[model samples]
Target chain A: MDGITRLVYGIYPRSDELRVLISRTERGKAVTGDLRDRISRETEDLLSTFRGSSDIYSEPCVNWHDFFRPVAGFLTGFSLGKLQRYLQTNTFYREPVIESDLSLRDRFTEIDPPENLPAPLFGNDKEAWLTLPSPHSIFQASKNPSGIDEEKFSDSIFRAYAEIATELGRKGIVLRELFPYSDRAPDFLGALNGKFKTILVAHPESRSLPATGRNHKFHSIVASNQLLARAADSYEVPGIYALDGYNTKLEDAENISRKSEIAREILSVPRVVVTSNQHFDFLPRVIADRKLAVLKSLGAS
Target chain B: MTGGLVTQEIGSFRKPEYLSTVFRKGGDDVRKLIERATLETLGVFRDSGLVNVGVGGEMFRWEMYEHLADHLEGIQFYGFVRSFDNRYFRKGSVVSKIIRKSSAHLEELQFVASHATEKIKVPITGAYTMTDWSFNEHYPDRHELALDYADVVHEEILDLKSEWQKIGRDQVLEIQIDEPAATTNPSEMDILRDTVERSIEGIQGCEFTIHVCYSTDYGILYKALADTALQGYNLEFANRDTLLPGINREQRTGYVDVKEFADRLGDRILGLGVTDVHIDDVEGSDLIKDRIEFSTRFQDIGRIRINPDCGLRTRSRETGFRKLKNMVEAGKAFTDRT
Candidate 1:
């Protein structure tokens, strides 16, 4: 706790049992009760791992169809479009067919976050974060058959998020799967300086992190170990969270330990955060479970 | 002489309702059902006048990625992941050293060989796509994993080609390596070239063509694959171009990459996609003719083979049939005029 701030972001993988129940329920074969209990059991296992392993962790979103879908389901002004490949991965999310201005139909927290999460995590919660795709990401993935201006569309999405953060008193907002879809940095990112924000780059490439000017105090950058090893030296950030979320070779805990030590020295920070760089939703439940024990082992020495 | 701008299919066609339902439920005699469905689809292809039938429109398989991953030794599926709205595919993770457990499409080729009178072009999921689609658990890196996959693909193709020869045919097997994931990762262009070359290298008496459709930028692929042993490219243009009939760059904007392909590569075929498969609105033969005529500006008409953008699996059987029929009519129209 003193030298390293272990953190978890993105959806954790769901168990096979839960997956079966979900499919059955969707097909009208099983009831929602069985599905709910299975998700809780899987989520409890995830939470227990976080208790000793990490300082800050988002609720393991075992039920998210994808990162964007859960949030998109609650928001208005969009219809589901054809499946587009999400960045470089094999997995896909339904694209938004933007029909109207975007806004949340209901409170973002109550609709998307699972019911079992601790009540304490919601109001001004710094310990747990609610994750959403950055407005720019949403704007980029959207299909505007009708022409929509970039700033107007993105601001409409950000206003709803701003309301949620204000209503819930959340201190940390994590926006994930970031990319430089446009020529310049997204304007919403500049307005995100008041509280702690962790920007998870989907694939850390030369163009992954958009050029940004920041006066934000608690801004942090988390990315895959491969990109960090290759070209993360020039990325200036207040905090660097390094994790091997993309590859399944149980990450060498020693390498992460060494990276964290170097990060503390180089970034001139006392404690560096660590978490998986992307969603573990596509990984087998067993491998994702094994990763929890590995996360617990970081900075133990 | 070949039919000018020979008509063909890219790969998948929508499975018949009975076969698809039974495929999900998993009962015995599914193989018989699959064969019946395949032959029926073959009937449609024959009536549509396609010169090259692709395993009767890939009827033996559900998807390109799952079909190959199901046959590999090192892959383990987690659960169903959504590839689109409500439709999902099993995305496997490579947990150990990969090896081909069995040939994915040998039985498929054998079936088509026995039934098809026309020349057969077998569409198999290429090595690069297989590697890019799976999660790597064991490989030291993605490059190593892709190379290992390349070996498996080479072996699978050689085995299939041998079976085709045993049938006592004089024709060389035309293999279309489906690589929809080719242009997704720009950093891995070198890996893409290496994997394609390794997959097709030293396979005598066979044609190696790649089917890469709907790429954001086809220029990357044209330049990167110029030196590979690949014989031609099957790409999509109707998805992006305007359907209002015109033969210029403005109307047929999607065929702009034809100049790049012709300039960079020498003497390669172009599987020109002249119809949009995603939409049900059938392009009349005149519209498809316009797209084919549009490509003649950048690529030689002799080197062009006609096709749909990607797969018609997304469309209904009736729609897929009509689209193919119209495309064939379009090709013949171009042929008669020339």
Candidate 2:
């Protein structure tokens, strides 16, 4: 049985650093081209390390503003654009920033496999899995109000994703998987999975039925399945369904069991991944106590 | 406690000196005031032969922002700072305090359970609403933050169950997790279900109830109930037409068409709302009875618990007591009909 593994690879320091940078930029701190290049290089290095460490999957490249801009623009763009004009009097095509972000993400496909890394790291046996912030995540981060033209935003996102997938395909990347972090990401999953071959859902809750109203995780999967079925009906590219993992709460053994059972049944996907491993702070102690096996068995290995 | 009603004083902790000095000076005196108010209200209910009493006040008080500021960083700090000015409580602190207050309240409920001949009900703000209302920072993500809050609630439930078991009480301890925010986002239905499951994880042996109402959106809420593992659900059926959207004036008149919705939900216990709390005047007993009778069409509904649309916190003392009396009288009438 093929199992899923969570290899944490992304821009180092993650959103925290990006937030600081954005704040600084807003404060009129000149972020030089060299500084931007250094940040990008550091991020690329992190992704390369994550790719080299395991023969399993490659991590998604991070472009902070790109990942954020489109959804933010869609949700708060009108108001933000108005504010920017009133404040800075600069006219900016927000779409170009979003497009450039996609282009930066696509640049990962061109990254030369590090020379010191073993040949198996770039071999056909290993899959290159990239985790993008789900459109729902973008919406959440942007703090956009509901009832926007989500369909149009989803279309644009899927088109950009298709472009990236096509570029990665040329790089001999066999599989491209997108992980939807938020519960509200099913619609985007529905849209993108049509183009991407494999899709993985990481629902955070361990309990509750998948169809419960407003349960976005369940909704996303259901919507994804529905979209796939519709595409199959229309002779569109048939995507393969992979596993769904649960990022459950601590000490919630019963819910974990319940979720594992449900994943086995409803998620026609190939695997069900669970995590017994705690956060980064607890990793050392967990490994020291040989508790890694417990997590490994749950598919976090 | 008789039929989910317990006679207990609303405990009020002193706020900082800057805000309300009256509550600080009158700690014991305030407790006496609440006790006196509760007894006086109970006397009126008893005179009218009402079986249950609902407390209408903001009883639990703690400076939670100050407590939680001690644990958070940067964005979390800014979030809390923004929330503090808005009078919003932190999710972690609120859950922690609820656990503490509920444990004490459960003991008081057990005391009432022992003395009374009927079941005692304890209502709490549900996990979803708590997540919606509170500032969260413990987890890196919102869903994770919600799960963390649910874990806190689960701990409280386990603690309360153990305390009840130690006391050897035969009376029912109905724990109502109030979820008004369940309707706002359909995606949250899953989180609500997960939170409910976590809240009731180990204590499957005890009676668990969920109360959801007071918001306009029921699309996700109805779906959440279908997917949740809850044993009993108390919904706002009264004033259904007036409050709920998509309902025509014809549906609002004298009765609601919740029977079909309830029937579709299968065997879960249905605690139908018989009185409209949003209204200023207390509903007459006959009107409450009619509402309960209308809900009896759903065959699976067991033990119809009569209640107003929500807590009587907004109602006047006389009005709240009169409504409770009418509700109890209506419940007795329904029991007699059965």
Candidate 3:
């Protein structure tokens, strides 16, 4: 696959139309058919743009930041509501999308291909990816409001995620990748691991260096183990572990190396990738870089 | 000395409940409250027609720490897990789960286009600090986690920028990415600089500021700034010089000499913190003025943004307000002189 395809498949797509859907929801308006159609069309356009591309390794055709602004805007806006819901429902801000947490639609009827998403987006030489907050993120997000029943919340999330996954699969858009952006993400790996080909696990930047010193070390380890164990149980193919570099303390490279070794030992996953300090920019690069290296290593290049 | 009472805007104080809920439950109320209070505080500052308003505290949810922990696994070195169960795992990870169980509240603050015409400063904690403070879990290596944190934050900021754009805001928006850990270690400094640059990249229209303090070595901070994309640096001057044994005093003092250091940093604005958050007695305007004058010797000081050494969450409301008022008065006196 070319770079654009890789990026489209590897990275999560943030659609402006989706943001409009979210905005309308924020305003307490029912999603209009026109708005829904626009969103579906945009999603289809995005999918077609990648599906039409012949070069899988070519540099992406557009600046990623520019391309995803609307999506990011929508997600941010949606986050505001998600956060508000956490406060109203649970009385705290629990991170809803960490690894340890449940899926958003485990019990709900699987997400039917979002009516807005095109049918052919993943038909040929293309893959679709979705990025969700980790289970730990749910817990963290819940911290803002203090009155949630976590067990019940987790159950509902699992139900919702299952529904979404089932629906997406029905649409032929394979959920090939999942990114656990926060500490709490590891908890729900079991639900997502079997469903996706690759799961990207993130680590805290502050702990990678000697400068941080024994702070939050315990939490980091447990989250990783949860993800690894879940992935081990769910997938026949080993999961991929991705690391963040910006928050890592460069002052002590030896210590960082040692930590990395320990992590490798613990996670026991295949294909660990290291990202530059700025992860978003570096994530695409790392994935692209690794894809070629993996092909070459396998003698396919 | 100014005689007016210095009361902190309600937004400046992050109550324990607020912190806990944001950390544990994931509510929107904390952010809503913050936005509401920020507007109220700004109104008070404008209504008082005070020459300057000492922006006091920030709404740092500890849950963010867990979020960081989940994404960055190398933080195990920091020993932050003593307080909770499953120190090995960060608390929240899934969006569906978080939304389902979250207790966060939301209150939207409508920003008038006219209000934003004048510079409105927004502060965000740096990826390094955020990572350092959280219980990271996602990445295997600390350096790797740092990079991921930077990316995550960059994404969030980019998203934030788009939201600002939709509201017709422009470059006058001043954003400060706070990095308390930048001064302490070389590795962290490198990460801080790189992450700050990444965070500021593409968001060209705004005035980007960086706040560096509460560390043993400030020299690293200066060095880090040489590589960052920010236009301003806010340094803590009041308590930086106080001796803290076992910690390198030279590094700390070097960090305090930000004015001289920043001068070498071309076109960078300096926000010199004149008020001490730790000091119980309110610092007089004269003392603050002397400090600003002292800072002038280090660099061609442009427009100075005065503030406290750090957030006023630790102080009584009365003390916090008094200190902020004094700092604002001192800044006005300086601005008038210049």
Candidate 4:
């Protein structure tokens, strides 16, 4: 229990203003000067709020759907569901299927961070983390896996990610987290381990960590849906436990935190980031804020 | 073949404009809207020639979790929790205690039963789906969690049935348990089956049906679930039509092969989905006829109940009406031919 050190918060829900901006942008509505200014101002406020809360691991309001849409032409249900915000979930995301060569551009890799935010928001690139959908998850959800060379394709994705990580690291970014859809981390995990401090946000469904070099922190999405009987008794690196993703009520937040603490204790992993299971975007700002306060209290040793 | 081409909605109806507006308002107005919606839903089914229809499930606010969660005793509505590709309700406790448990759906069901002249089937969110879709703060284990959920659901169903009897309405033809999350975790197969059994344990009056949608990879667990003594297994077929194995290149069409499902289900009903709910494109009567005909080749047509892949909640009011109408027309066409 004593090994549990720092508690880092990441991916807070998008502020209403930011959500409005993103929705308008996605809808192809022309967002001009006033709206842009409003978005920037809102972004600063949201970031400052998160920064004040605790150790900020990731940006509060990054639209992850904007990434990896280049090869969506070959895939079905690869983009956002036009009818609803989430395809099947309440959270907004694009279920990307890497069908072919994952070609990248600077536009895809660049962190806009919404200009006119506070200097700390802009400057703490070193402390900030960039989350990428794992190459393994992309490959698993791919349409025609037989045609693509697994090694080459994974390496290609890793190389692009590596370039981004290198650039971001040069700018002072400390970590890059992979949102893995599958249990198997790509072969390039070892390679990326050599480049930067990697973190794998374990998919709630696939709780098992990929058999790779211990180069990443395992962020576990411990929804109370499953039995706690199989929680990892030990870990190679420090782990993070994210509780209360979709519909966790406030009353249960502390209980979840306590359960997560027990799991952390059982694992005996050092420096766990006790946070929400998924991005807090599904919640309203006020509710998300309340959740953060609750988590901050419960997360503290 | 006694009940001439059995037709049922998979327990959801798209809210019409009038009803949608009524939902925005509250108090007595909401009850009036629910009554109106229930009547309209029955009309939609009757108009479309569907024999067994639901009470619209409009009171559910287009979400299965919200419908039941709001009525439960001890639930903390955490905003959202992700499972696989979707997010559903997360909570501390699904059911802390069952005393004085009441829901608007129960009231809606009573109203529907009182007014409905036709055979009625009620959609109950299954124990597994409720627990699987929620975050548990109380239960010691998954099995215990699911069992607790089963107890709550079982109690709720009994309450509904008890009220139905008290109202002097005819028996509820079927109690459909929608379990979209049942097959997601393979390890929980036994628990899922047990949950279903426990939910419908002593209920004698109505036939029990478990509806699974989106994914069909039930493995050996399908057989296990069937053995739990369910009357029917309502499965999504048309939505998965594209994924079905085709005979040739140009002839890319075939009725979904549910022979294995039929064999596994034995004498139990196979509420076959003849219409696609996920796609906007309306499947013609000819297509439905073909699908039903193909199903007959493997299973007894007498046991086959024509239905859409899942609930019509995601579809528009017009689309749902059209789809149901098309399904019944196709079922009639098939029956005439047979």
Best by lDDT: 1
Candidate achieving the largest DockQ:
1
Which candidate tops TM-score?
1
lDDT of each residue in A1-301, candidate 4, tens digit only = 2333333344455454555564455445745454556555765665565555555355543333322332232222233222212323423334454444554454433333222111122222445565554566555445443376667666777677677656556321222233433444343444455565555555555544444534432333222223223334212334455545454445355565565566556655444545555556555445677767665555334
- Mark the regions of model 3 whose C-alpha exceeds 4 Å error after superposition: A1-301, B1-118, B135-138, B241-256
Model 1 chain A poorest 10 in a row by lDDT? A114-123
lDDT of 2 by residue, B69-115 (tens): 22222212211111110112222322232222234244344444444
Classified by CAPRI criteria, candidate 3 counts as incorrect
DockQ of candidates 1 onward, in order? 0.35, 0.02, 0.01, 0.19
lDDT of 3 by residue, B1-338 (tens): 12321222212333434343354454576656544455554554554344333332334334334433343333333211111111122222211111111111111112323332333455555777664544334555446655666766666556556556776654455566767666545655666677777767777777677777655456667676676677877767776543232223342343346645655674676666666775687877766666665666565545455667766655665676667667667666766777
True contacts kept of 1: 0.45
lDDT of 3: 0.42
Which parts of model 4 have CA positions greater than 4 angstroms off?
A1-10, A15-42, A65-94, A109-127, A165-186, A193-197, A201-237, A240-291, A294-301, B1-3, B21-25, B57-62, B80-95, B98-100, B166-172, B243-257
Could you report the Cα RMSD, in angstroms, for every candidate shown? 5.2, 16.4, 19.3, 6.4
lDDT of every predicted structure (CA atoms): 0.74, 0.43, 0.42, 0.60
Candidate 1 chain B weakest lDDT stretch, 10 residues: B79-88
Two-way DockQ contest, 1 vs 4, winner? 1
DockQ of candidate 3 compared with the true complex: 0.01
lDDT by residue (tens digit), candidate 1, A147-252: 8888787677667767766676665666774454332344345455454354444434424344334354325555433333333332334335455556555787
Number of the candidate with higher DockQ, 1 or 2: 1
Task: Give the TM-score of each candidate.
Answer: 0.82, 0.44, 0.43, 0.77
